[model samples]
Target chain A: EPEVTQTPSHQVTQMGQEVILRCVPISNHLYFYWYRQILGQKVEFLVSFYNNEISEKSEIFDDQFSVERPDGSNFTLKIRSTKLEDSAMYFCASSGGKPQHFGDGTRLSIL
Target chain B: TQLLEQSPQFLSIQEGENLTVYCNSSSVFSSLQWYRQEPGEGPVLLVTVVTGGEVKKLKRLTFQFGDARKDSSLHITAAQPGDTGLYLCAGIGRAGDNTDKLIFGTGTRLQVFP
Candidate 1:
C-alpha cells in the first residue's frame, strides 16, 4: 500500500541532549506532516511541509523544534534541547491530497 | 482553536453487537477522516468523507458526514474483537488548500469482546 515509514521506532535521550526523528513519506505524496501523541492525550499537530517549506505549524512546535527535508526521500524533525514533556509518540504522515497516511511512529523518551 | 469532541470516550460490547461513535466540532471542516489505532502504533486511516451529508460504507462499517460539515459519525454493525482499538476523527481546516493540517478528535476507545 506504500505507507509512510519512520526510523528508530524508539528513541531514548538525555533531557538536555538533541534528538532527531526520521521519516520517509510515500514516494509520490507531496504533503508531509508531523504529529505527536502524549500518553493518554489526543494527537497534536506539530508541522506540515510542502514545496520544500513549512506550510503550517502548531503552537506546540516551538523554538526547540525544527523540520527538514534534507534529501528527496528523508524528512527529519530535530529537537535542539529535549525536555521531559517532549516525550511522546511522534508520527509522520503524507498525502496525495485529502486523506493522509501515517507511519507506525517513533517513541521518544527523555531521561 | 479547533476542537473535535468525540462522545462516549470508551465502549465495550459483546461480539455481534452494533455500535456508533460520534465526532463533533463547532468549527466547520472541509473533510473528515476516521482512523483506527492499536497500541504502540500510529493511526491507520479507514475512511475520508468530503461532502456534507455524505455516507460511505465499508464492509460492516458505515460513515456519515454531517450536513453542516461540523460533525461525523461511524457505525459498526456486528462488530468483532478485531474491531477493538482507539478510533479517531480528524478534520482538515480548508477545502482546497493542499497544505492544511489535520485536527484530531479526542478519540473513542472501543473494546469488542469475543
Candidate 2:
C-alpha cells in the first residue's frame, strides 16, 4: 500500500536555527495536514493545506512556521527560528477522503 | 475548538483479555478515525467512521461511531501482546469543503500482556 514518507526521521537543531521537515504524501491524495506531539502530551493540529494553499491553521502555527508544496509529491514545514518549545514529533498526513494516512514522523529536537 | 477526550489513558491487561476505549466530544464531526501508534513512530490509520451510529469491525477490533457523531468507541476482543499500543481517535473537520483538519483525542495506552 502507498504510504506517506518523511525524511530525516530524526533531527537535532539548535535554538534560533532553521529546520525543515519534509514529507512525500501518498500519490493521488489531495489534502495534507501537519500535526505535532510533545512527549507525553496529546497531539496538536498545526495546519491544513489543499490546492496548494492553506485552508486553516492553529495558533501554534505562528509567523515562524510555513508550509509549502514545492513540488507535486513533496510537502514541507519550515520553522524560521527554532525554540526549545519547538521540540516534538512532527507528523504529516494525506488523504483523498475518509481515511487519512500519516507519515512515520520527524522527531525534531532543539537544543 | 473541538476537543476529543479519550478515557483510560493507560491500560495494561493480560493476553486474551477484552478491552474498550472511549472518545468523547461536545462538537459534532463529519467523520471520526481511529489510529494506533507504537513507540518512536507516527500514528497509523486503523479505521474511519463516516456515518452516525456506524459500526466497523477489523478482526478482533471493533469500532463504533455515536448516533450524534460526537463520540466513538473501540473494542478489542481477546487481545494479544501485539495489541499493546497507544490508541487515538481523531475527528475530521467539516468547516470547509476541502477541510483536512483533524482533532486528535487525548489517547489511550493499552498494554495487553502475554
lDDT of each: 0.93, 0.92
- Return the interface RMSD of model 2: 1.0
DockQ score, prediction 1 = 0.86
TM-score of each model, in listed order: 0.96, 0.94
Sequence-dependent TM-score of model 2: 0.94
Runs of candidate 1 exceeding 4 Å displacement: B94-99
DockQ of 2: 0.83
RMSD of 1: 1.7
Kindly give the number of clashing pairs for every candidate. 0, 0
Weakest lDDT window of 10 consecutive positions for candidate 1 chain B: B92-101
Encode model 1's per-residue lDDT on B1-114: one tens digit a residue.
438999879999999999999999988888999999999788998999999999999999999999999999999999999999999999987445554788899999999999
**Which 10-residue span in candidate 2 chain B carries the lowest summed lDDT?**
B93-102
- Model 2 agreement with the true structure over A1-111: per-residue lDDT tens digits: 899999889999999999999999999999999999998898998998989999889999999999999989999999999999999999999989657788999999999
Which stretches of candidate 2 lie above 4 Å from their native place?
B94-98
lDDT of 2 by residue, B13-57 (tens): 999989999999988888999999999888988999999999999
